[model samples]
Target: MSFKNLPLLGTAEIIGALNLSPKQTASAANLAHRVAQSAWRRQPPHKRGLSYEEFASTVSDCAWLTMFEFGALLALGRHHEALLLADASRMVHHSARTDPPK
Candidate 1:
């Protein structure tokens, strides 16, 4: 299944999936930071009307979508697709911080 076709989960569902103990998920913090960074990178710079909380929320949603796509690709045994998603995610993150969207 393509990532786009994957169902969207609520915040509660996402949090539930990441319910592992801190020790069991040593990279959780890093993953979260990267996701936030990615979202900021993808946000458009001209869109200045959004408050900080709104901007963060939008970024968080994008990060979650990317993660969902990544997981879906993996589940479909599409390693190449997963890699592409990962690359896109990284690009979104780096670009947002470096270039400022729009």
Candidate 2:
């Protein structure tokens, strides 16, 4: 048996959730991942449970869901949005490091 038929490894797994071709998956995944930070999130921002679980599981991993969301925007050449997301992620990390825990 071969593992080739299995789900992707590393970052490739990100776009695999979207049924995309191998060549397009990497960039698509990167773009979606950065911009789709809220893809699986509940719109109202306070709800979480089994219902949310089902919604959350739709893409297996958050990165995949993010890819599904941002892939379309990437298709439209939204590189700036993707960059902004990356910067925001960095800012979040920096803040977390600087802030004291409550």
Task: State residue 27's C-alpha deviation in candidate 1, in Å.
Answer: 18
lDDT of each: 0.53, 0.49
TM-score of each: 0.43, 0.36
Location of the lowest summed lDDT over 10 successive residues in candidate 2: 1-10
Residue pairs in steric clash, candidate 2? none
- Evaluated against the true structure, the overall lDDT of model 2 is 0.49
RMSD of 1: 9.8
lDDT (Cα, tens digit) per residue for candidate 1, span 12-102 = 3533564534332323333444545565567687876676456656555666656654554454456797799799878978888899557
Among all candidates shown, the one with the greatest TM-score: 1
lDDT of 1: 0.53
